[model samples]
Target: MQSVVPSPEGLAWAQRLVRLDTVSEHSNLELIETIADHLRTLGVPLRLTRDESGRKANLFATLGAPRPGGVILSGHTDTVPWDGQVWSEDPLSGSVHDGRLWGRGSADMKGFIGLVVARTRAWLEADLPLPLHYAFSYDEEVGCFGVRHLIADLKDAGIAPAACIVGEPTQMLPALAHKGVHRWRCCVKGRAAHSSLAPRAVNAIEAAARLVTVVADMGERWRREGPFQHGFDVPHSTAAVGVIAGGIADNIVPADCRFNYEFRELPGSDAQAMQAEVRAAAAALEPAMQAVDPATGFAFEPICSIPAFSADADEPAVRLARRLAGGGETTLVAFGTEAGLFQRAGISTVVCGPGSIAQAHQADEYVTLEQLARCEAFLDGLRRPAAAC
Candidate 1:
């Protein structure tokens, strides 16, 4: 297919945003303040909801008349880190080459955000029949963390917009459903002793290994079991231990070990129940460790929980997105997004945006010019009568 060139202003906006480094580990204040300044200059009323540390924030801005049935165009300001990845150009350069905008977040999201910000003037001049909002959040790559605070702020302000559109690199397609993500950190404590005196101490690493096996076994059971959703890429709920660390020397029985694990579950599945099952397994192994040392046991910490999201075919948010994108079939994605959180807050939500998820988080991530043009057209459709509630 021939690639359509995107609007120069939109391209410039995308490149400008992509140039900023808003990796999840780092603060997103620069990006947030930049967009805040632009919106403020345009006379848009906006609010900033900061995290507990006051280093990161979510930006919520409004345009047009203040009404109940307004629509929100949402995107995350942060991108995953590109450390240790080999790339042809600097990840933050935001270069335009070969009919695509290339950068760390060009596809994963900044492209959609940039285009939305570029449309602010157009939306303002149109005297929109219904209000339009911009919801740019932080730390989405790590989990849907920042958006939670944004939603809470909205609730406090008593603003109940009818619908939300989360732009998360859907190749310009609307996504109606996605899996949930629940993660945890587990720490095991035991007594350290010489290798020859190992029986006198509980082996923390060995205990953690047992827990890892239990998680793996559960994942395998889900893979072979009957509860399944056919459309998703990974058709069933899955679990795995991603990181683990323990021990100091070969001669010592490790006194402590830590590991991280997660579960990506289907829409109707009980993710908490799965977590409880793992906790039970850990509890079952605790008595043996406690017998060896009073301080030896297991500790678990909740990391992040992104709920599963699904929208009915006839939902207003889904209809609006499909109509603006020239009408395509809705999709189901394996990855998680803030749409679920929005839905939980009583806002009808759907995921749609420029680019493809396949290109996200890669060394040479890029969003095609064609996708940007399509996204711009979709945003322009908001000015039409059919889009009004």
Candidate 2:
């Protein structure tokens, strides 16, 4: 089969997709419906599946005959928030300048999604020997929720891909591994009292401060004593508190305090064990706080768990990705992505797409026209049948 090059129409489609503001928190139902309709017209078999909330959705489309070993092109439809950044152009306008497409999700994701959709037309036109599956997910910027359902559906149907290429921006290089992210919220409960008589009441804020100190101490210990074999810039797990809230007034002892923390762990590290350490520290603090007043307590709730993915350098999928990416050496990234989840589902996965991670989650995120063109060529190569070994 002959691989088809990206058409002008495909570029136009990508531009239109960039115009839709599907920020992770915003509803992506319209975008999902539009893509589903477009795939149906392109002779791709598409099924629209929704999570329990229906605020977001997943679209699974396939080309060529269904088979055991196929290729899955995956991308997230949601983007990070662009709430407080100064932009040279309208963030959602998909403006083009200097041969680059600029928009909210131009780099973080929608660019890759557009490329995959554009290539779908070529796959549909050719008589490919292997099937090509496209999985578009929502809320990836928040957590890996949308694809979890899609993966479960595929597993339920006993359909597993031979390989999955997650179109996360890698500047056209192949990424074989990335760190995992674990997010949690901790709450400290205490009794409130007048500042003048604070000794009689337990202060939630004070308890939370101790908890934060424990987290910082643990982070430092991990940096000093933890394994550091990974190639990540940090080279070890990192923990930090991102948000905190407590207190009513300077005069009153706070009754409740809450904060969210995250851990970016290296591949193969025990993320759960790290979380356990934090929990234990919080628990130990609780007894002290409760001794001041029997009402003090602590609780921890998980927000998200993103697993890490690392493929062996000699793996067939990595080799295929290198070839498709024009023979660049495989590398690792510190950010989290859905590639790990796909790999855990028994699909050899690699991360290779257009643009650079530097531009992701920025105000005027953009993807160079050159990178887009390279991605188009990569997809075209995949459409062609393999030569005899």
User: 1, model 1: CA deviation in Å?
Assistant: 11
Model 2 lDDT tens row, 88-206:
88899887778888898887788878878767767777788688889999888888999999999898878877888888998888998888999999988999999998998898888
Q: List the residue pairs that clash in candidate 2.
A: none
How many pairs collide in each candidate, listed in order? 0, 0
Report, for every candidate in turn, its global Cα lDDT versus the true structure: 0.92, 0.84
RMSD per prediction, one decimal?
A: 1.3, 2.6
Model 2, residue 196: displacement in angstroms? 1.0
Model 2 lDDT-worst window of ten = 1-10
List runs of model 2 lying over 4 Å from the truth.
1-7, 387-389
Q: Residue-wise lDDT of candidate 1 within 28-141, one digit each (tens)?
A: 999999999999999999999999899999999989888887899999999999889999999999999898999999998999999999999988999897899899999898
